[model samples]
Target: MSEKTGTFVVTHAESESAVVRDVETAQVHTLASNPGLEVHDVLEATVAPEPPLEVTWEVIDVGDRRSIELVDSDLEPTQHEKDLAADAEVGDLQQEERAGTGEIHVFCVPEDEVEAAATDVLEDEETVARAARLEAVRVEVRRAPDAGVLSVRYLPD
Candidate 1:
């Protein structure tokens, strides 16, 4: 079979085995060997199914790999983002893809829970990886208290 190449996020990794999820397709692959992979690592690689049973996959060629960064930005959300949040109901999340690369996510939350919600996003690995799918390396979390919103911007290096 032909090899598949794309961005993959390490969902789980250990000494013996590892699991990677394709960022574009959301397909999951189980690796027979860890190959020094670590959880939350994003890899740009070519993979092929193992011979015979084809029950597992192998990282045949690695092009690039990196760990995403999640940071709490002191910068406030942009005015447009604030307007988006103003239109959204509490507990709603709105996502917009950037014109070039990356994404902007505006989340409407309760005024009292803004800090906690921001912290939750910062700690969630899947959340970060989801944003990084747009070729982002850094995720900036900003709070707009007046709008009771949290703005998460996925940015390139």
Candidate 2:
């Protein structure tokens, strides 16, 4: 009996069963029971294959479960981030861990589409999940309009 532990996103859920996909491995697992999961819920869990055919899985343990919030940040990008944006080439992306906690993602987009790109990050679940990763509670989108620069900050609390 082997168990896999990772961050999983609930892709589908029903009264009797549910499906989750591992964020890192992209492997899909069908659970033997619903476990009260809901669509888009992110979970830190351990799963093991069910008995018999072992085609389905069971949640052996759950370390954490959370839903992330995405909002347009009123705050402006930091001066240092602005400098990075100015120096980065178009379509360039820079990812760095926050000094304290969480993560920072910086992107250089087309000047005209910076707003649209930011909105996409706000509305796209997968995009937000990819940015937020593990233990992120909220995601903030800060855009430098006309500078073709955008920043997505993932916060732990």
CA-lDDT, candidates in order: 0.87, 0.83
- Candidate 1 lDDT, 72-112, residue by residue in tens: 98888999999999889999999998778888999999888
Superposed on all Cα atoms, the candidates' RMSDs to the truth, in angstroms, are: 2.7, 2.6
For model 2, the superposed segments whose C-alpha errors exceed 4 Å read: 123-134
TM-score of 2: 0.80
- Write down the TM-score of every candidate: 0.78, 0.80
- List clashing residue pairs in candidate 2: none
Tens digits of per-residue lDDT for model 2, 4-76: 9999888789999999888887789999999899877788999999989899999989998887677799777
As a whole number from 0 to 100, the lDDT of residue 71 in candidate 2 is: 72
Query: Quick one: how many clashes does candidate 2 have?
Result: 0
